[model samples]
Target: MDGSLKEEQILMSSERDWTDLPPNLIHLISQKLPDLRYFIRCGAVCKRWFSSILLSDPPPQQLPWLIEYDEQFPRASPLKEELPFYSFVTGETGSIPIQESHRGKVYHRTGHSYLLVIDGEVISLFNPLTNEEISLPQLPSRFDFIWPVFGGADPSRNWPWHISLVCDVGRSRYLTYYLDRMRWQCFDTVLHKTCNWDGMLFTTEDHGTSTLVFDAASRKELYTIPPLNEETFGFITSYFVESCGELLRVSLDYNLTRNIETYIFLIYKLNFEGGKGQPHWVKVSNIRDQIIFLDHLTGFAVRATAGLKGNCIYFFIEEHCRSDRFYNDSTLWRYDIATGTCEPVPCPFNRCSWFVPNLR
Candidate 1:
């Protein structure tokens, strides 16, 4: 082969136009992009790619991303720069720049695909990718924490949100206000957790030992978690995940260490298939092909696909996972549900939660 021919081949490859690809093929390429930043970059390549990205607003099988807290990594300025988000599929990191007035706001809580952020006295549901926010129902000016329940947000019409607000004042009532409802509904219950599967609020008279579902929309008790004898499991934290239309209670009894490598997890499934309110805790040894990701506070389950590992629980280790000791919580891990083993998942960012980016 001639040297000139080889040189021309290199130049031809370098100058190839990606826009020449078919629109249907471009659309297929856009469908697999998990990060909004990737879509933006692909769209910037050419007009055809831009139109392709715009048309693929809600991608098929949107995987959750791990968005690190702005403070978790070194930045020019926490308020000046964008927050980095890592995608599990692409193995790439993208930044979500703080737009307009949301620069100073602090992150409060993470929902399915949204975040509850507090901007002084006003609390808002913020979607970082699209820069869309909806003001939540006003509190009594002295609220402790608010959990945003993710429902119809983006690529769809605005639907009601079942948001839980825990007030730490005079009466100390656990209240939840539905966006569809006009008034805030108060519950006498203490421990509060929102079941992300069906937007059902799980609360109990006891402090997290037993769980019950409280529906603020109708002001009714939908179901009750039978008294789980804490004396038996003796777990410091009872992490609950609703998967496949079943309520699962994962009991972890471990003394966490920086050097330690494994953990013992007792998995329990609520036997409510027979009927509602008649469920009992059944010990399950196998988690099969389902993958669980614990996004800081709540655990999210997804079917293992692509090259992703399954039969494992991806847990965010808040404190020791970061490179800097000063940074409080910023680490991710994959816990094998079968072997009760865990390993740190290497990523460039931290303080991760389940995030589905929506441009629509």
Candidate 2:
């Protein structure tokens, strides 16, 4: 306290009235603030700061908003649990309540105003921000769930949206939906996992060991990453994420049998240099000061704060326990990319999804 006061006295000694600074200078100060908490605090400091916060965007790269849920959706929220949004920059978690009218499983995030959901034949897009909704034609009777394959350089009218869903379980049959033509391309292919930023779709073979990507539009084989080196644990899984324009592969290792209390993480970046060359996995020592947010199925990466450290991964750690007495230790965790270590994070949420608050 004394040190802070001393510093303030030293600044005041200059005999300069900071509040008299022009609005442009004040705006520049707000633009330089990377953390949201400090940004909000600056707004309360004075009129100029408050105006700057409201007039400008928080930052170009905002942290992913994590939304928490229970074991399964459509379950009764006896407690009326509220969804929490955690920010990596501020190291704070803020909750936004789910309305009583809002029900059914949150299938997938479509946009800032829409979330795509499917219930049997009915497929709808609900906007929780404004409580508005728009329902499209019912999905084909064959597909059980809808998974969207997004990202690419050309996301305009050229490529609307590429989605895949399971049609037949026994035959391992699936179909891809192209929005431009309003047609479903049905085929039996590898487990259509995820896609990258360049409109290439990726899949795994040999029991989730190898990765192969192909052009979704041309239907031509692009290339494949090397086979994954298995981890010691039996419950290891891999996921592909489009991060800050680069493609990243993350391997998560955990103990399914028991809560052994440790997590292993390996992060690799695909090196693409020299225009058209063979792409290979490179062990990333740093993520260029970014953090990857991972759920079970899909994940995204964002610019991490300097205080939080870079090359680290944030995971929604689900703690599975015995006795089945309705207990779960679903805590947020941070895994260091450089040291290969894991630790508990301060933010807490049960069913959280990566979200960005509706600024609109």
lDDT of 2: 0.57
Residue 228 local lDDT, model 2: 60
Model 1, total clashes: 1
lDDT against the true structure, per candidate, is: 0.60, 0.57
In candidate 1, where is summed lDDT lowest over 10 consecutive residues? 72-81
By TM-score, how accurate is candidate 1?
0.76
Best-matching candidate per TM-score: 1
Across 1-360, the per-residue lDDT of candidate 1 in tens digits comes to 999999999998899576888878888877776555566788899887777667765465455787765464221123335866788677887777878677766665567666667766776677877778877666655455555444322222445543444433335445544444645566544454444335456654322366676554565777776666544322245566766656677655444433335445667887766664465688887777677666533565666765677777776655523334233333666778767786766777644566766666
Task: Please give each candidate's TM-score.
Answer: 0.76, 0.68
Clashes per prediction? 1, 6
Clashing pairs for model 2 are 65-355, 67-352, 67-353, 68-351, 68-352, 69-351
Residue 286 C-alpha lDDT in model 2: 73
